[model samples]
Target: MIDALHIPDFPMQRTCPFDPPQEYAKLRVEHPVSQVRAPTGQIAWLVTRYEDIRMLLNDPRVSADRRHPNMPLTEEVTPQTRRNIAEVGRSLIGLDRPEHGPRRKMLMAEFTVRRMAAMRPHIQHTADELIDAMLAGPREVDLLTALALPTPTRTLCELLGLSYDARDIIQRSANAQLRRSVSAEERQQTSAELRAYVDQVVREKTAAPTDEDLLGRLVLSNRETGLYDHELMVGLTMLLLVAGHETTASMIALGVTGLLQQPEKIPGIVADPAAAAAAVEELLRYFTVVDALPRVAVGDIEVGGVTIRADEGILLSFASANWDDEAFPDAATLDLARPARKHLAFGYGIHQCIGQNLAREELHIVFRTLFSRIPTLRLGADLDDLPFKKDSNIYGIDALPVTW
Candidate 1:
């Protein structure tokens, strides 16, 4: 074990706003699984290598339950707050084994490859409509607001049976939840507000349910089989609302920025629909918006030539793993044609993103439509001045100013 005083901090600071912390690259090369201190002052194992991260992610001995007292929290959570999240948080992302499997199975059909494929036309149309509005509005506009934010927000709201009017409030709350700078008290309050809104919507849907939308389907199915209850419905929809939009919204902004930096690839991605899919995968691997995933070792586990003792917290660094040279040769270089589908951007194993199929479909349509329609698109601001979401759990630019 590394000396407690010598352990590097887990969420290391970044030198460049666009890249992962330099420590991650160094650690991946030197110590693949090194002990580190978290923001919460808890010492944990920071797993950086691609092979080790994938192994640990799939290992049953690693638990995703955030309420574990020794869990390495990126954000500080009071015991009461932890209880609130564990009890009321119906997020499949945070559950393990028996509890997680059944809950995920219930919603798996909604995001299956076939189901997402069937919705391609609608996604395409939504992308087209957003781009059409962007073109008509102004030559110089903030793409993040004009397109990146709305495309996913509109699509997720439609699927979740949420009102478009609630988008602003929901987005605000989700932002607070992921931001590192937000105080624990403020985060708890925002979470409560979000839960309150979801509670109202779930209750309304339960009283008068239909199978037309995802949330409605869940409600109707629950009524039939008693598989879920009102609180579970609230938690599930809240998870969907935040996960469904924030992650994809961040991708749109960052993906567009990345494409603009390498304009030569724009034509290829825009010209060929099949190539756009590949480009999306490459972009996901290159950017890796979400930084790390938290897990706790439930049993003594060994990986990357290191042993993580039972009860030790672990942070699987997605950004570091994606850049592992062993996994992707010349990993730092972004190649649209490179087969990058194995990247952990969407994660791996059972806890892998449930909304991945939907996210990918959205990305394919958005990138294809945006570039095809605005073939002359270019950045309106200097790269250095751009504000990146350095403080948020999800990495992305705050706004992407663009002009054709």
Candidate 2:
């Protein structure tokens, strides 16, 4: 094991756009479960191997509760920042044990394969409309605004029965929360903004409730229960938006960028269901945008021949694991037909992304329609000049300029 003096800083810089920081490859074999200082200046374990990452995430001894005093913080926290963490706990991502299971089960009712299949036509229509509008306007435009951002934003807004016009309100706060470069006060401010936005929507629903959409349905069914309480529902609504919107939006843009680099591989991605599914899975693993999935070790657990003591913060590196040579052969090379569905891109176990089905459908339809209709599509900007979201908690491009 490396000495404490050499422990690297957390969220190491990525030297390659297509790969993680090379330092991860060194740690994967040498110090698989190693400690690093977070931006908050607190020590946290960085788990890098695929097998160990999978094991620990599925381990019950760890907790996802952000309220844990020792849970990883990417930035320094103030009293209000601690309050922000507590408030964020109301979301499903930060819940643990009893609260997590029941909450996830309730939300899972809306994300079943059947339910997602039903949304295919709607997603397709949305994709086509955006493309039609984009093509009519300019020969060259930023795909981020034209398709990527609006695709998930509009879908999520309509799903929650919120006006699509409120996307600016949703995107602004969501972006702020994902950026570690932002100060704690800024993070706290955005959290409150998100909370307030959700509260207003729930209030309007409570005043005139109907079973037409998710917000309305939840309100109608849990009228006399805590599940429908104003605060809880606001948290739940915010969770759905935070979980569903930004990540998928990032993936859509990055996925197109990746495919554009390998044009010969585009047909396979658009040709058939099997090929497309494999391609999506490979892209998920290839990128693994959610780089730092935080957990607190609630009990001693031996992983990677290292014992992570109780209360130690853990940041599971899905990026390193997906790219681990032991897990996926030739992990650096993107092979769409390699049957990569088992990759940890959506994560593993209970805390895995609750909105995976919706995300998958959105990406599948968006990519299929975008590439097919705009067969001549190519990057309008030089690949080297493109800005990557290295500073944000989510890994993606800031913008993708494309033209056919």
Candidate 3:
């Protein structure tokens, strides 16, 4: 029987900085599916096996519905929850079934092969320009501030046709939104500012809609059908802006740090595009930045040989799944050449990251260009001394100090 009082805390601490919490390995062996006390003090099942998480994500009985009373949350229970649902509507992250399918199909049009191909050149040019500026300046710099942060900030601007001049507002609001350290009021305020900014841009695009950018394309294609109105467009765009910016920036910074720790892996990756792409997959799996995907059981289901009752909350542990030896051989060691596509980095199932294609383009270009341009680049600080973003739900390096 599952013990209630002895339930482990949902988000276990990492004994080592880079590797996941050691508890996952033990749990996978003894209790792949087990109960844990959430930060909200509610009990939820934490699923640590790869096969189980993949199956549940595709299962009809599972749901991403944030409105579910039993859904586990990373943040502590607060007034912010109700306010967010009221203001944000059923975002792409929370939608299910009939609503989810069409919405995702409609948005996927923006990230089509032809569109990503066209945007690739612009992404490449932006990375090169950023490198030129960094090289022209001081030898010592924070990679987080220099290349990692601005590359995504500007690329998203170009993709959406937003004004680059407003990067301060965009970057500031995005950086603040995900931070657990910030008060609920502060996060709400930042979210409002970002939404208001996107709303302004949406209105501008609607007045003179064009097919030149993602936002413009959406406005042109959907406005005629009355399918995507002003408010919906603003909310969706705001989610894209915040989600795309913070996570990718964090990945880039963290990826660079991870690469430097094993400089031997750096040359083979930076020297070839194919190698870089493969290395990207390995890095994605290794970090598995977002620790777990929050879900709630819709009906009774037997998983990992145990029965979970309906309406009970569950967390699909991505970090644990990615590191499972059954799925990934020698998962502890970072092998850049590993056929790691099966990993759940962007996530699995319908609600998987919408901006994933865009993220790939940014990461591919940024990683390749930075190291190729500055061969002498080396870390400015030791890994033990560097600050990590443990407080944020999105795990990454807070700052990457380096010198070339």
Better by TM-score, candidate 3 or 2: 2
| lDDT for predicted candidate 2 compared with the true structure | 0.85
Clash count for candidate 2 is: 0
RMSD of 3: 1.8
Stretches of candidate 1 above 4 Å error? Answer: 88-91
TM-score of each: 0.96, 0.96, 0.95
Give the lowest summed-lDDT range of ten residues in model 3: 80-89
Residue 241 of model 1: what lDDT?
A: 83
Q: Please, what are the lDDT tens digits per residue for candidate 3 over residues 43-146?
A: 89999999999999999788887887777876653566445643344657777787778777878988887788788998899889988988898888888988
RMSD of each: 1.5, 1.5, 1.8
Looking at candidate 3, what is the lDDT of residue 146?
A: 84
lDDT of 2 by residue, 214-326 (tens): 78877776764445467767877887887788899999999998889889988867778778887888888898888878889999999888899998999999999999989
**Candidate 3 C-alpha error for residue 53, in Å:** 0.5
Off by over 4 Å in 2: none
Cα miss at 235, model 3 (Å)? 1.8
Candidate 1 colliding pairs, count = 0
